[model samples]
Target: MTPTSSDTTASPDVSGVVPPTVTAFDGNGDVDPDATAAHAQFVVDGGANAVFPLGTNGEFALLTAGERRRVVEAVTDAVDVPVIAGVGAPSTRETVANAEHAASVGVDGVVVVTPYYYPLDEEGAVAHYRSVAAAVDVPVYVYHIPSKTGNELSLETLGRIAALDGVAGLKDSSKDVPWLAQAIDANPDMDFLVGSDSLLFAGLELGCTGLVSAVANVFPELVVDLYDAYAAGDEDEAQRLQSTVFDVRSAMKRGPYMAGVKTALSLRETDFDVGGLRAPLRTMDDAQRAALETDLRELGVL
Candidate 1:
């Protein structure tokens, strides 16, 4: 039977800048729980309302199941703020297992990306989410990133998923504003999070309550300020910061995909040694790093 959206209340406040933090690794190319937890604390201290580990920025697909569980434990233990761990996997069974483990570790919620690599129809998509949502007691936030997942949830499908018991909200990284607008309009009870750094302000303007931002991983203050400005009724400041974010996003894309955030973190004067991206995901080369430094310095973010 298809479960309808239960009157399960929303999860803890996830309504501000939530950084999809990188999973910190050590010299041995293994998960460094302490370092990973420390990074989570760093963002919370930097004004992030919450921390989301094991997302795309965290390289969730690359980590082992045990490693992902350790990250959830470490981050949840390290910070007082809510931790929304990414529990998405390629299969519904794996996603349910991940979500159950995350909930076991006291994560405030789990963000389940749509099953990826294989195409899914609306019914399959809804069933996948329904299973995950039913398996865990914690709130489930659907992660809609078609660019990576290769599965896009239609508005009608999203509505059905939103109705599932324990399904709390969604993070739309689809970058389709019209679809996002329609989804927001259709499900006013569910919180919508904008997943792209480029669409933060516009997403908030469209009634999104929170931002699941990659840029926030390295520069939480920038994104937090953007959210605060909008909440404070400072539209001009919000837009100005959004423009700045556009520049930062462009600069971060200077190197191979998903490398800039870690590179930028290393470039900062902080004591964080996040090691580097796992194998097959290269870091920024010297020349690209230099260019990113120049861009950030010009923007006064360095």
Candidate 2:
């Protein structure tokens, strides 16, 4: 299918606790479209400013191309907020295909990560993102997570990529404070969404537009409150909330990251049956769950 034009003029103003939503599954281990839609709605109702479907926490790597498109369709249909689909694949062609599919489905933007498995040089990374951005008109947020992609996008290379026509902003999961600081300083026009919940307050203090936090999948209201408080200039409240959020994040990080998210969601008042993680990613053991529950209770999230 030909890529649709995303001439939506204004760049999407996406910010604040956009959950890298988990792709809900049924017992059969297939993508449960209805449950996935319900989960998206669940988070939005819980106070997410936007929905980011098929991201790292959503297990984008495990999903097939068709599943990826379908997940975006379901999420966009379910939420009124901007849906930024993660179209990062190991190859440029696949990433472009995913971006085209996201555009065709009417998602507001696409988050394209560095092509993984095979490390790409600065020029290769720039070219990869440029081709994907040119293939569609929708806003593109460069996803920088060298820890997972094995290709660290340098500040210079990132600047070049940000200058692309359709590029809108960046989501930095790199956790490299110095690099993030440099990127923020160099690209004043870009909207930087921090991917770590632990950095929510710090990121906001650094002038980050918002957070794309995994913890939001479980505690959307708290995450939203922290962002709102900080944005509202309520430093004391934001600081308190950030500390509590840090504790919750520490507990979740005790297990497999995404599985911990799904497990935590299962305990919430959600309409979706967010089954389990995809293959090779198992749920937390009984002891881990018990410890997590205790921590959540202490944090008043249970």
- lDDT (tens digit, per residue) of candidate 1 on 203-274: 999999899888888889999999999999999999999999999999999989889999999888777788
How many residue pairs clash in model 2?
Answer: 0
Native-vs-model 1 lDDT? 0.90
Quote model 2's TM-score.
0.95
Candidate 2, residues 1-302: lDDT per residue as tens digits? 11113323456768777999889889989999898998889889989999899889888999888888889999999999989999999989989988998999899989998889998999999999889989998888899899998999988998888787777788999988888989999887778899888788888888788799888888889999999998899999999999998888888887765567887887775666989988888889889888888888888898
- Whole-model lDDT per candidate: 0.90, 0.86
Candidate 1: list runs displaced more than 4 Å: 1-5
> Who wins the TM-score comparison?
1
| Alpha-carbon TM-score of each model against the true structure | 0.97, 0.95
Pairs in steric clash, model 2: none
Model 1 RMSD, rounded to 1 decimal:
2.5
Instruction: Report lDDT (Cα) of residue 298, candidate 2.
Output: 84
Off by over 4 Å in 2: 1-8
